[model samples]
Target: MVVSARITNFLAYSSLTVSRVSHLGNGSLRYQWLLCRNTSLLQLRSKIQTVVPSITSNVSVPKENIPTADALVRPDLEGLYEDIREGLTNTQPELRQIAQYYFNGEGKAIRPVITMCMARAINYHLDQNAPGVIQKQKKIAQIAEMIHTASLVHDDVIDVADSRRSRPSVNILWGQKKSIIAGDFILAMASGMLARLQNQQVIILLSQVLADLVQGEFMQLGARENKDERFAHYSEKTFKKTASLIAYSCQAVSVLSGADSTLQSIAFQYGRQLGMAFQLVDDLLDFIATSAQVGKPVAADLRLGLATAPVLFAAQKFSELNPLIMRRFQEPGDAETAFRLVLRSDGLQRTKELARQYCNDAVTQVAQLTPSPYQQALVTLAHQLLHRMK
Candidate 1:
């Protein structure tokens, strides 16, 4: 979804990094795969070359992964996600089954993990003795993840997608109507968890994220005609769809941390900037990554009649793209021509530059937090997001 890159002076030279985005929903993985004993970096290098042949690799992946919440948050943190289905335990048998499908195996857990990390970081900033696990904030993390998974479930139906995480899509396994119900069930469960938190501010913050998801989907249904305006439209839609949850979730955790409004605003900014960067990288990858790599169709955006950052950038060099985007590629051969133009143009590179800028901005905003292992981990996360591959 939404996330960035930049190293701070306090961070070790060897920092956490994510080299791939292996899957989207259940079993979503990032970077740590290279550290798996069975998987080698050399193998990873060859795989990256094979999967994202369009983009030339530049940033070097570390042979050894630095310690971060990706590894640390497991086992003990498992409870945060493991039994979320229990929230719907009282539902009808089939309803519970569809709702709990993805919850069976956690995805990357990016939103919730970052939420937990932010809570401690902000607590340390306020001079509190932060606990290893704060119940309410952890609940917020769970809610964030629940909201994310729910959106993806609905997204599959909207995209008419057949697979997720290399597995049959919820809509594929169970018809679209059932998939829609399952997605709603997930959101309903998330809402229940949110209300139980009893923090009005938290409720309000996450509630906005819910609204943004719908608004983003609406935005996705069309594209702007003006070249410059299209980029703005795309970026704004990206913020609402992918970044909103991450940004607000971070802000929600900051609120729970009892941070002052100023600190809370900064925390929200950190998440927002990173979320923007994360989606930009994803847009670039659509042109670069294969269907086998990212677990979704390559150029899925184009197939959906959407114009992302890369296509917008390409339009500057090849004015012909403007008409295709406006028509939603309705004309025959439009999609193919646009694809070739994007590859030959510097669109991906330019888009990557913009993504990195946002990543850098994310780093700058989080730097305000008092230095803590949690804060450092957050910083390392932003840095690693730039190079995310899966």
Candidate 2:
């Protein structure tokens, strides 16, 4: 039987598939992952073309050759930080500083970039000769940044993180109490901006993201005993925490473009898939990336006693990890042991494979739209997320 190109490449790269790998004597799992890192460019190009023909006929082009989604949003994002700062300004100088801390143009602004790209793509889909992005669409991008940054501030407080993007966290500079208030302030401003859109449906859609963020945090604080249920819980939390904002922002842009329900749903699906892919890559990075590379602590999830995708996948091969996961990895050496075991297992590889699946789905979703540069950018953006180092 002919296997799908995705599965073929995935299986070909590793000497042992997950099912075939098991513990050998001396309690060590025996596996070798000889991936295509050393493959010639021509070979990689051929493989990508086979796996995702829908995105491009001639694939595996050098990074320079791909249409960069970042370029598409550069002009619009130029003044984004300034606009956010203006909105977050407060009478009290210290409060204003705290509220506007993350708007200093240091972060990647991935959410806004995705929102702007989706908005333009939806606009062009509805009208082949549509003008540049409308004011309301741009507002959505700004609101997305604010919502995302606000979450980061609150998360720093909860995670007790001292650094973010390689800089001191808000909670570290301003006490935890003040950081929480500053985060709330940013959210309030974002809410006001969202309301100004004057589209009741858009208002409701974006509002749901706020609720999802809170609920996701609550879910992250605990673990389930059942393996099946634990994975489900993790999936739900991932969606609520990361995908909710992106999915709704894309849908709101479609609605603002006057696209019908079908188009709106299409936009939502694309963003949902892309967002999930982005988070999976992030989770994988937590285990593999250095502090300088990720701009934060390495293995942060494990340090926080959170069992992310890599740890969960590793647990399947090592039953010892189950108790550690349930106890939140609080015991001495638990985090270190789990981290080492995950690296030895195929957990990181499996996470990357799952991320590729979501990225593929995202590409497929965006392809349904009328062909345009903006639409193509969306597809490229999904692929970029799958391979991003940070």
Candidate 3:
């Protein structure tokens, strides 16, 4: 157990800068960017030293200062995660290998963690003696994560993305065809897991989520040539592509736990709002977060001809910017210009406001739950989704 110090520093620096940004004066944006850039460089240097220790004898770090993976993961979900990880690794070795490549290397596993938290919240409130409840919850969480990972794999292929989680993408490592096959394999495996639940409602919800994911991809692909119309299409796509899974995840848990229809609807709404907020924030991070922090090139969405929320908002103010954004991002300088335009536009602020509104709605949805630590954690999770830097 010891975790990497680089991750600890990234979290520390990112948190500090995000907090300081709120108090910054109007003219201090450049200064803030410099601060972020310098911190990111330091973080990168630290990572290089860790990955290739002998190559950099000049770099020395304190062992005790490093944080553990356990610190990032919620302790309440540890047992559940153990089961999920075991199942994933044992059942589908190839998918597990790819998943391990991504999971062990980066990502906070925040989504499944949230799913487990919601499940535990329900379990705490009702069904004190529900047999096999923990097993079912863990399986659901794992299946959800598998579907998510599969989507990312396919997304990288579709976007022609070279990097993910600060490393070369699976498509880059193994080739696009293999990457696509791997994604499809994971999707099939995930479906099998869902079928085991023998719950028709869960199966239907997840099947619809898969369909929405595909529809979103197609929508983005079709809208590539039309810049002026990209915003509406992109917004609708984000709702289907990103928000639907999250919404259904909440609904799935509620149904599995035998909660009333009203509670299930509330949970679904909470997740939908939170997922929209999450994607909006993700779009903002593409412009604001550093390459090292975000684990992808800045403005990657724009480069891929996929208009994200911030870019859509920015396009509203500068109609002339649409042509520039529609151009395939294959050119060397296109991404930089897109980045600067987004930064200078009011879209960033507007997108943040929209995300905050959704976060507020998420909090309201969960407010009806009786006061408990898990309920408070859900509210905090919603806020975290809105405010997280990466």
Candidate 4:
């Protein structure tokens, strides 16, 4: 039997069919993935086609292809340090210490990197920032990282997590209450900085991202009884919990550059889709990756009773999972049972397709912007996400 699916809701619509077979270089199965491209995605697919396989290390990243991390962040590195230090500051030394607990200089900084590049790319003066605006845009990047770290601190408390980025989480290093306060302090600092930016629109945009984060957390705490509502709820929650900051950060930089609404929306759209795609990949990782790779335990989401994209898609064919999802997998053996079912089903494959669809939208969104190596790096970044096994 053959199964085909459309992961349209995430972005573009296209039915993909995967057949059981031999092998596809990197993995066990000889899957087409078709890696099918709908007409809407073709332009995007073609643009980044070369970069995808290379960044995936099917080949090398080569010297002259796109902007590297240094190429993008080096110029603004000193300012990022100043801005991040400023956000973590407090007169009370202990409070300041707790606030800076996660700033160990090991973060991937994907959000800030994207924001910095987007700021430069969207500026009317291509390949450069508009004088005073360059400094402000770098602040936006700094703020993005600060706000993201703040959320992670709170999330560790929320998830009762002990480790992040392969180290003891803030909640583990400090106590939960202290961790919570630190998270709040960081947020307050970020808010004060946001106010100082003095762009009401920027404040409103980032502020809304804050609200979405709350709503997304609440959504994660419960599951909808209806199948359709469950999927819709999960999608929105994914955006709120994962994508909002990335979306608004992109839009905020566009705003900083004095781009019009249409352009700002395009930037937001790119980030919104990219952020969701990022989380979907994370959800998928919970099942497929090892604890060592993800810097946490495997099946973390399922163990926590969260039905992510994989479980939801698996439920479409495995009736047993529907009841399990509704009950939050509280039954004695529910998580393991659901885990076994997902492993045997096409859920992983389908989820990958869904994520790819979003990346396609991400690529398309940025395609409209002025072309530069930075812009190409953005596209390269989206494709690189597909290859992140961890």
Candidate 5:
């Protein structure tokens, strides 16, 4: 029942966002209702002031109990890359290089680290005295990273992005066709690795991530003309593309660890919330960070004609953005004008505030577990995500 409720809450938000676009003009009561229904920025501001304190009050875990961010990824950092490389060894040399290109130990492997952290923490939660990560759990971590990297490769092709992580993208080096093949190849290898896990339930759970990735890309290719519906559209896309993998990956590990349905739901909820927050931060970084800082071009979303959280939030204050969003900033200076408007408005700050809520919610969900270093690391990591520059 709890699982059903959580899943419903997750989908309800999506449904609200993608609802039919009302044709009523701006000043009508019905129009106002639709606009405010998804919690307008004004409402969010009030909620943030009141809700954050209440939420933080529920977090009983102490600061001293949490582990450092370094402690979270350091243990498995070296072995994770090696294992991922080993997974790629059976493929052809060129495919192997393209598939393994982004695994160069530079970027922070946040997904796998979160997976392993959840695995160990859940392991400890189930057995307070037995707090070690099992072999199968490690495989899940590797699979998560592989799936993530594969998505990045495909995304670069779709976005026609030339750079990633301060290096030339796979699409740039290998061309779009081979870059796509490379992405597919990495996914195939990850699938094979998943099959060896031999857990039908876990396999099904992780497999859904592949479908979500495709669905998200489809959502990105289109735009919502209705201002009321755009934020919901963005949220849904963010979940399908970014959050589903983390949510399902965390849930898969929970299933592997023999967690009860309730515990598994908690893991999924944590990952769902954290994944949304992570992407929100990424969207914010696109607006505020430099090309060198984020290792990718700034304003990439705007250039791609996509309206992310920041742009969506900024739209509320600037009606000029409505047509720009509808047409996807295709006009000369549309992207530039929209970018300036977003900065002038409170979009960046509101986006940050919303992300902080999701991050706090992640911390709250993980705090339900039995207190342990691994659990504490998960909590600490959630907080640290807000401050990340890249």
Candidate 6:
């Protein structure tokens, strides 16, 4: 779904890029067709002209060129999706409510599903006859999700988001004070769940992850105005806010199941890369995805004064975009203009490339593990992560 002005221009001026367009996921391709179909080439050109005002003409699109939905949904992800849903449902009632409201609705549950898949990958490799492996893996998956859910509750309060997953946010439904308490409650529950495992290593790992998560959020808030700051701030925030939990989630299962250090490290690295890629794609989607598709308003991050990877990348090219970004898109119509400028620039492409790199790194890390159906599933999951539209 990541497209640059260059690509749009290419599509407008010539039919060449249409054929070269890659299908990352079925949802995105389907969405693309929906957008392209709802507006004819002439109408699309007109819209583009309204925004850019410089583009003068329309382009043609062959009806048969668009890919179908059947091509995108690999059978493997279906089971992972089911397992995640089941895991969330089986948790405590309050936790389950939180999961149902936030996790089930807003998120794709990519991280926890990947955690379970990777754990199963290593588990199946170690001992096919092992007892309780599935149960253990499921519990680990739940814990990962709990951490994520807890963060989201807090995030809604922090961001002052009114809606999530197309519904009233936890803060909106239960007030900010209760929302903060609920977030802390989930964190406490997650901590207790990890403590019950009594694995010093896993407990330490998750504890550090919580710290990193807070630090990342703090850093992001502090660096909101510094457009010239190294992309490392974004990178670090991504790690703490997104990657660390995923990395630990996978690694914890390895330690719980007594995998070798090398395998455990590989799992952690795989999760880290995948998590970073997930956040990058999320940032990309904020600009490109619709309110319905993304489960939140388009450009919500920019509207909230948060500068993500795409905005950061775009700011590098359009220096004038900084004041708008720094001022939290305070000016009237600033977000719309900023969005158009980024779409027109190389920022989207750069962001996609960065996400692709992380996906590649994740694939490489998981490739180190011995080949099995589960390993293949993990690899497929990694590929699926980069291409996800919603």
Error of 6 at 25 (Å): 19
Task: Show model 6 residue runs off by greater than 4 Å.
Answer: 1-107
Query: Cα lDDT of all candidates, in order?
Result: 0.70, 0.73, 0.62, 0.70, 0.73, 0.63
Better of 5 and 6 by lDDT: 5
lDDT of 5 by residue, 13-42 (tens): 333434311000000011122223433333
Report the candidate with higher lDDT, 3 versus 4: 4
RMSD values for the candidates in order, in angstroms, are 8.6, 9.5, 11.9, 10.3, 9.4, 9.8
Q: Per-residue lDDT of 314-363 in model 4, one digit per residue for the tens?
A: 88778889888888877777766787677666677667777766777788
**What does candidate 1's lDDT look like per residue over 1-390, in tens digits?**
232333331012112232211111111222223224322223433443344433324533322455685664554357765668777677889878888887766377888777777777887798865563367777888888889988888887887776677777787788889989988988988998899888899899999999988887887776554665665566567777888888899899888878889999988988887787778777776666655666665556665677777777778788888889998875766666777777667677776766666766777787888877777777777778877777
Cα displacement (angstroms), candidate 6, residue 149, comes to 0.8
Worst 10 residues of 3 by lDDT: 19-28
- What's the true lDDT of residue 109 in model 6? 60
TM-score of each: 0.83, 0.83, 0.74, 0.83, 0.82, 0.74
- Compared with the true structure, model 2 gives a TM-score of 0.83
- Give stretches of model 2 more than 4 Å off: 1-63, 128-133
lDDT of 6 by residue, 30-55 (tens): 12222334333224224433443211
RMSD of 1: 8.6
Candidate 3 lDDT score at position 65: 31
lDDT of 4 at 299: 57
Q: Per model, how many backbone clashes are there?
A: 10, 0, 0, 0, 1, 0
